[model samples]
Target: MKTTERVEQAFKRIKELLTLVTDWTKQPKEEDALTKEFREKKLQLIEDLYKQLGELNDRFMFTHESEFKTKEYVVQYDALKKKIHDLEK
Candidate 1:
């Protein structure tokens, strides 16, 4: 698959995971007891996302330098980073 396609897929997955995070946060009080397991799973998902993000960054930096494409991936990477940070907290 093309780099652009790969990046787009990563973005979609990140957005989905973010939605999961939001839903997890909105769970009722009774689910509070499962928060630890829920968080661990989310954190693991973020780690996997980071792997893809890192590959995209490396491709942009080392293979080809296209401002338009790099900007696109960078924006998604930044957004995913922010989500991961929020979940970490």
Candidate 2:
């Protein structure tokens, strides 16, 4: 698959995982070994996506034409992290 397609899939997967993660995210929840490992892998994938897509000016994901959508992605990502923060407090 082309880089464009790969980028597109990455965004989709991230969105899906973010939703799934947020659903289960709770305050001071203890992760089992397998769950911790899975979360680590997901974080790595997100970091890799940021590195691969960070350079593009016009397109973060091909389907996202407007820059605002890209910013929206960041907003959602931040919100997810913030949710975890808020729940912990």
Candidate 3:
């Protein structure tokens, strides 16, 4: 895959992990038998996504920080994150 594609995938995975966490948050009120398992799985996914995000950040650092130094990058990143957050709800 291309570098941009890989970055997008990492973002997508992080979004998925965030969604799982959000779901877990809403489960505290319920006394369901599956709650513990759900929490565990969400936590694991969050951890894995964190590691992947770190790697992606490292790659971004090594490769073109210059490309992301502009206002456009800020705008795009914020917009992407907002989309992710919206998905979580």
TM-score against truth, every candidate: 0.46, 0.31, 0.38
Return the TM-score for candidate 1, rounded to 2 decimals.
0.46
Model 1 clash tally?
Answer: 0
Q: What is the lDDT of candidate 3?
A: 0.67
Residue 10, candidate 3: Cα error in Å is 60
> What's the CA error at residue 7 for candidate 2, in Å?
62
Q: Write the per-residue lDDT of candidate 2 for residues 1-89, one digit (tens) a residue.
A: 99999999999999999998988885656778998998787667666555544534334455545645767767666665555455344
Which is the better candidate, 2 or 3, if ranked by TM-score? 3
Worst 10 residues of 3 by lDDT: 80-89
Cα distance off (Å), candidate 3, residue 59: 0.6
Off by over 4 Å in 3: 1-33, 64-89
Top lDDT model = 1
Q: How many clashes (backbone N, Cα, C below 3 Å) per candidate?
A: 0, 0, 0
* lDDT by residue (tens digit), candidate 3, 7-41: 99999999999999999887456567787788677
Per-candidate RMSD, Å: 23.3, 24.5, 23.9
Better of 1 and 2 by TM-score: 1
Where does model 1 exceed 4 Å of error? 1-33, 66-68
Winner of 1 and 3 under TM-score: 1
Q: How many backbone clashes does candidate 3 have?
A: 0
